[model samples]
Target: MVFWLVAVGCLFVGEASSSDNKITAKSIRVVMDNNYPPYAFLDAKGNLQGILIDQWRLWEQKTGIKAAISGIDWGEA
Candidate 1:
């Protein structure tokens, strides 16, 4: 499900480290289809809102690593 996908994505993110095996990046960018309801989509105010969005926000709070989540068209994904 979406949870597993997000988990796997987080794993890959950690793999993008430097030669000393350290993650030098201060933030991470995540792009997904904006049309997927309940998982990812825009709200009435044109703001990103969904279960996945909330999850990422929580991840940011827990890890202190900013997650720049963006929603794009399915075709663009």
Candidate 2:
């Protein structure tokens, strides 16, 4: 489930030139809910964790795009 969502999200990053199919940028900013468990949360070391985090890793590996992932409380998400 999370894997599909992350994969779809990667397709819509829109940091590329639609007309020419050229990349315009290589970085993305993402905010995940730290309050959610197993889906999104912060680890003991203050790093993002859970299924979404792992999926993002795969997304970066396949697309060569850099994502600056961050975690915030539910209210912010």
Candidate 3:
């Protein structure tokens, strides 16, 4: 999934952003489950953690673009 996101960013960076009828920015917005451990979870320090965060680091390294993540309830997903 991380690879796919990076790929999509690389392949169609401007095209999709331009077509979307929403706010536009150079960064990408991503939402994740707040309590899923080893994937994405809130830490004791109230920071994002787990394997997905590591993956996101790699994604940012490869894509050279920024990603903003939000943790929210699955129902809100």
Off by over 4 Å in 3: 1-25
Tens digits of lDDT, candidate 1, 1-77:
99999999988877765335756678999999998999998999999899999999999998888999989999998
lDDT of 2 by residue, 39-74 (tens): 888778988889998999899898899988888887
Which prediction has the highest lDDT against the true structure?
1
Candidate 2 ranges with C-alpha deviation above 4 Å: 1-20
Candidate 1 to truth, TM:
0.69
Off by over 4 Å in 1: 1-22
Higher-ranked by lDDT: 1 or 2: 1
TM-score of 2: 0.67
Give the Cα-based TM-score of candidate 3 against the true structure: 0.63
Model 3, span 1-77: residue lDDT tens: 99999988877978877787764456898898888888998899999898998898788788777888888877886
Compute the lDDT for candidate 3.
0.84
